[model samples]
Target: MYLFKKAKESIVSSLHGDKSSPIIKINYICNCILKITLAICLWLSSLSFLALYLNADIINKSLFQLFSLSSLILSCLSFIILKRKNGTYILAKIKMYPFSFKDLVDVSLLTGVVTISVFDIILCYLYLLVAFAVFVIATCSIYECLDNPYMRDNENISSFSLSFISVLYMGLYVISNGVIFRNLPYNPLEYMGYIIKNIIEDIFSVTKKLTKLII
Candidate 1:
């Protein structure tokens, strides 16, 4: 809730660009937490992408090694760009959309990496949930970025664009590679459209049962 409040404030501030306005200020402690978390996400991304590439032609190999390598390069670039505190200081400020991938958003995203890295068939099906999650996050992100004054700047857009593309790839790689269509129970790709919907319904069903039991 605090993060969302601050994110909302930052969005408003960007529209005004007023120094006095409360544009997403990252205090010492929160800033520290964000840096640490993003660093961990970046690290996991590196490792996961590397693992995927090495396992290319294996079950979990979703993306072409070339694409994985490109993602690695983008990660490295974003890392360096984000590390530079001066010009990139804007990142820590009006943070959302473009920078979301390189920022706090990756924490949730890393769960998909677990699915990709794990060899179990059951684990791979987690991709359905991950896909649903990515959709929600991406929709929220695009909503936040929409009509924001900060998005007008080409450089700022570039920063966000690069990070955004990498994240898109990450989300896509998660669903495409680690995911199986349950070919045995149905024809290939037959149930692909309903997979995520079914998974969500099943989750709600289980949660409802748990609630009833507790009651």
Candidate 2:
């Protein structure tokens, strides 16, 4: 806890873009706790599914019950953590999207769509959901970081261009790599796709820099 506080203070000072004296480190420990807990819960949920698939006799009924319990616990934790923060209000002041119920719904839908597509057998929708989720999440995250009050440089058009290109690269990469190979499921091709995505992503990133220069 002390270390986290210290880290937050340091980050605040850095964001101020100066050697500041006193910085009231935002006490978002509850958010951090919930985020970590959420990750664990998700991992456990995935593991439960895997277990059910591998050992249907033992895991069939229990898997559903465990998943339900986990979901409930995670929901309670999220509600408790978000209740006081009201991220929407805080984020509005910064001219950015604050974490809210909408984001939760989006993420839930994304996860469901991705998992079903990736793990389903016949009649599978392929990896479209994973690719789409990756694109959307990456876009939102980049936009948020670029628009953040603590770090944005409104005067620099280059910054905006760079962020824009970064998002495009991420979107393209995920689309090509995720959706294209779901049915085949080849190891070497999957690896190649990943490599190609990175290359393409980097290539497109150069365009942003070029555009910045031209603009």
Q: lDDT winner among the candidates?
A: 1
Clashing residue pairs for model 2: none
Model 1 off-target regions past 4 Å? 1-21, 27-34, 53-56, 64-74, 96-215
Q: How many clashes would you count in candidate 1?
A: 0
Supply every candidate's count of residue pairs whose N, Cα or C atoms clash at under 3 angstroms. Answer: 0, 0
lDDT of 1 by residue, 68-135 (tens): 44434434444544454431333332121111211222111223221111122222123224434434
Ten residues in sequence with the least summed lDDT for candidate 1? 113-122
CA shift at 153, candidate 1, in angstroms?
48
TM-score of each: 0.27, 0.24
lDDT for model 2, on a 0 to 1 scale?
0.39
Report RMSD (Å) for each prediction in the order shown.
22.4, 24.4
Error of 1 at 170 (Å): 8.9
RMSD over all Cα atoms, model 1: 22.4
- Distance (Å) between predicted and true CA of 8, model 2? 29
